[model samples]
Target: MTKYFRSNVDAMASYIPGEQPQHGTQIVKLNSNENPYPPSPAALAVLKNIDGEWLRRYPEPFGGEFRQAASKVLGVPSDWIVVGNGSDELLGLIVRACVEPGKKVVYPMPTYVLYRTLAEMQAAEIVEIPYSEDYSLPLEELVAVDGSVTFIASPNSPSGHLVTTNELRKLASQLSGVLVIDEAYIDFTEENALVLVEEYENVIIIRTLSKGYSLAGLRLGFGVANPKLLQGLFKVKDSYNIDAIACAIGTAAITDQVYKNACVAKIKASRNQLATDLKQLGFHVWDSQTNFLLVHPPQKKAEYLYQKLKEGGILIRYFKQPGLDDKLRISVGTDEQNQTLVKALSSLL
Candidate 1:
């Protein structure tokens, strides 16, 4: 570690993102919860029509065009929306804006690991409330934590379960600090907590195009909250956080709700089939509301299956963390890719 690095920076372990192999290699990628479908045709059209001259100028600092489109779809006013390079960036922004050094940032254990890393970067105290044995949200425990910022990943990653809306509203009402509902995969779920933004000034809901819109490569995400909370986030955000092309393409993607919904429908169907196949193979599959499954295999260890699958040209996620060691997070992929995964697993077992 460098001598000049901040003590917190030196001590913190950076977040590990999903692996991305080199271009052109053959692999069935189910590690990252990325949409297997193509982005909306309207988004592609926007990219095709990008004027080279526009690249010479800076993008709208606050991503007005994208926010306007998101506003129309989400039914929130434009001022209540703030676009980021991705929801990850927005997560960091929330920590920086709401958490002071030594303040607390609370989240459920076994949720997205990035929340801990972000809090660590800010030198904030992390309060992790463990989920119930069934992996349901521990609403009472979370509400008791004296945190400056609380993160709840609805339809949480690694375990595709969602916290009930009533439970979330109760927690939000009881919390003393900012409540951030990270709804990255909520598109696949039946309901969302966006309505809480209008009901509670402290509630902020973040969403991304990565999973639902098939725009992971574009790095587009946004957060909606009361105008007051958004004003604070704006202060901490990068001056030109979003690029011009991303704004144009994101606007196109959000405007084409039909295309986005079509892709989501396909993924949801595939998720069900994948879970059923795994269950049939004697694996324990958690009921998922997102485009992925948290599966516990029948015989071999999760790490072993992960390695064997990789050798067989399929990739899935296996977290080395304590509670997740026995499970694998398999992203819902195209029909062909999913079949390849099932065939590979059948042979390994």
Candidate 2:
């Protein structure tokens, strides 16, 4: 019975999300990088309106309305958009499409962590290019990986440092592979790589409604790339990846630019204040262009701090991986939530 599983399945290394503890009412959850705010009024309205028909009929296989909404909002054509349950689904699809048995997939170390896990699931050779001490994208070294597929998370995860346009352009020009850019945190940043897809056929950018639009639980995301690349993906995707209720909520969220901008602005402000305060407390707080911060804690060890925070009804993420062993990733919560986290940290330190 133990030998029945495929070798790839048995050896598979899974992606670990931050803890979701349900025991406390006053808990401040700064883990999982989720938008601390709830979904927009428009999204809530759509959710409220849903009923029997939505539950009865199958949704459009391609997330047609969501695509159209994203197209109008992103200023890209609908043909360039492909919606998924979350950007994770789109990532898994890309892995299935581009990775053949022996082909390789390369991404920076200390990245989203899922890229390596997804590559392994495809049985693709995994190439890990370490980031610099400053956590910048090592494009010069990354391009050297002998792989046909390269996945990069812009304003990358855990550390939230974005790759510059110049660095990305250099990779596009030099690499012959499909360069998949995960922009899950792009809303918090001033720069984006969406325009690059027009100039480079190989650039695929994945986005989510989770962070920017505040619809994580709805599971709405899209991958934008050239039509040719999306066509290849269509063959491997599940028929109705986007459900009816999600499609409705996602469309409303993407179209409501005013609401989205306000939320992003608030989160950015919170992130900056948190970073400054953490630095003042003698922690090496990384400057983030996203909604979270990767901080080196003061006084107590990371594991100890994590436990103390947990006891105080606050949850932040701690990674057991090498290089990140001493760091904790904290998401920007609401104003009061942010204040509570700082206070808890202060008392503990």
Candidate 3:
């Protein structure tokens, strides 16, 4: 088996996801930044009443209906978007299509570990630039690396800080290859780099229904870029990448902007409150634009709090890597759920 695998596949470290319990609803699930609210009623309606006969036919290639639904919302034409199983898949597609072995792949350090993993899969040269102490983009260093694909995760995970659009435009202009901005958590934030897509032909923005629309279980996401850039991805993607069920339900979800906005508003409110609660408990909380907060606990108790919270039936993210070993990333839950977490922390600390 060892001899059969590519050396890159054999040597690369696998991406470790947050813990997923057997009974998700049975516990306070906050380790993963999933939507706390139920899906849009319109989407649920489609889910419950999808025509069984449509399963017999292959799904419309490239999520035809969803592209149209998301078009009106994104203000992009259907052809400008390419649907995928999730933003993650589209990312892989980009790497596969662009990166030849030893070609460079660059991203900011401690932003998203998946960028490193994806680069390794391609056996590409990985260049990671460290963010400033305030988590500001190190634009000069990032642009210096001429990578085949450069990733920036806005409202970035683990830190929950957004790179400014002006900074992104600057980086995109200097980079020789595609600039992939992963905005999986953009719904919680007010400003985004969607405008950059229009200004830069090299830009591709990756978004998911998982966070904003309460569709984590559905695994549907899409990338918005110039049609010229997306044509290569379309050629490399699975013949029928999107399923008929997802097309129907995701269409319903994206169309109901009111419900999605309401859910995002609640999460943003909870995120603010949770940040305040952590600060009161002697944790240094960062100003966050995403639905999660990155906080440094008092007395270097990051691992202690992670274990104690789990023992109390609550889950939050703790990273053991350098620069993040002393911090924890908490996903915003329902008000009641967050109250339970804070009460537990108050008792433990």
Write one digit per residue (lDDT tens) for candidate 2, span 21-106.
76556678999888877778988898889998989999888989888988888899999999999999999999999898779899
Model 3 weakest 10-residue run by lDDT: 21-30
Q: For candidate 2, which ten residues in a row score worst on lDDT?
A: 18-27
lDDT of 3 by residue, 127-187 (tens): 9988877998988888778688999999798788988899999999998899999999999
| Cα-based lDDT at residue 179, candidate 2 | 94
How much RMSD separates candidate 1 from the native structure? Answer: 1.0
lDDT of 1 by residue, 1-349 (tens): 3498899999999889999999898888999999999999999999999999769998889999988899899888999998999999999899999999999999998999999999999899999988876987888888888589999999898899998888889998999899999999999999999999999999999999999999999998999998899898899898999999999999999999998899899998898888888888899999999999999998757999999898888999999988889899999999888888998898889
- Once fitted onto the true fold, the runs of candidate 1 whose alpha carbons sit more than 4 angstroms away are none
lDDT (0 to 1) per candidate: 0.91, 0.88, 0.91
Candidates by TM-score, descending order:
1, 3, 2
Query: TM-score for every candidate vs. truth?
Result: 0.98, 0.97, 0.98
